[model samples]
Target: MTKERIEKILKAGANVVLTTKGIDDMALKYFVEAGAIAVRRVRKEDMRHIAKATGATMVSTFADMEGEETYDSSFLGH
Candidate 1:
């Protein structure tokens, strides 16, 4: 998603779950600053290293999430 859209979601009180291939320091900082949670997918062999480096939880899933609006705002700040 675009930064603007992500910001709008954050403003709307939705908790974010960023799923990306790699985790960069800048991306980590941006997500934290925006009050969102992020998870990075990495090779099983490198999962431990990546998780240690970026502080992002790793998960295994192959589902397609395009155009799916699954974020809910009710669970935030409680």
Candidate 2:
């Protein structure tokens, strides 16, 4: 993903990111610069448990966000 895309996610109020995939170096830097934490390679079952505990939704694509000019903060975990 590009810096702009990363910015979009940050702007959506997600300060912590948990993913089952690896994050690129540049993206990690962007997240750190924004004071966010990105945890990669998390187990799928763990991710589901985290979401369940925090009330966050897991998204695999940016398609839902693409049509909108702004991201929905509801996707974030508390």
Candidate 3:
């Protein structure tokens, strides 16, 4: 992801991020700088399991975060 995208996620209060895609080195660095954990290349099934276990909603993009049906920082798991 781009630096600005990562910044918005952090600013929205996510401390742990899980994704089924690769995370760029710069984005990883940004996560470290913010004291957050970013785990990439996770399997989709595993992601589903995590979400079910944590009561966290999965969203694909920053734009998807817009509305009640979508997710905000409050939808994130601890």
Candidate 4:
């Protein structure tokens, strides 16, 4: 995933589910700085916990998810 995609998920009020091998702390930190509640490193087995913690559903996809979603600018601490 790209920085834009990470921001998109945060804007949607959803936590990001990053693959273990692909867990980028810097990216996750950026999301949190952008007002994300949390970023979770997930394995297939950890999906349940991720869902429970974030209260957001999970999706499995191979397509590149690297874009920004709309969000309220006011929520960005501006």
lDDT of each: 0.54, 0.87, 0.83, 0.54
Writing each residue's lDDT as its tens digit, candidate 2 over 1-78 gives 678778888989999988899999999999999999999999999999999999999887776545744556888878
Task: Please tell me which predicted candidate would have the highest TM-score against the true structure.
Answer: 2
lDDT, model 2, position 67:
71
lDDT of 4 by residue, 1-78 (tens): 668767665665554344545646787677678755444555666865755565544454424446534443222221
**Best candidate per lDDT, number?**
2
The positional error of residue 20 in candidate 1, measured at the CA in angstroms, is 4.6
Count of steric clashes across candidates, in order: 0, 0, 0, 0
Q: Model 4 Cα displacement at 67 (Å)?
A: 12
Question: What would the TM-scores of all predictions be?
Answer: 0.36, 0.88, 0.83, 0.49
Model 2, residue 34: displacement in angstroms? Answer: 0.3
- Model 3 C-alpha lDDT per residue in residues 1-78, reported as the tens digit of each score: 878778778878888899999998988999999999999999999999999998887877666534433235876875
- The CA root-mean-square deviation of candidate 3, after full C-alpha superposition on the true structure, stands at 3.2
Q: Every model's Cα RMSD, please?
A: 7.6, 2.0, 3.2, 6.9
Error of 2 at 46 (Å): 0.4
Off by over 4 Å in 4: 15-18, 37-40, 49-55, 62-78
> Which candidate model has the greater TM-score, 2 or 4?
2
- Better structure of 2 and 3 per lDDT: 2
Runs of candidate 2 with Cα error greater than 4 angstroms are 65-70
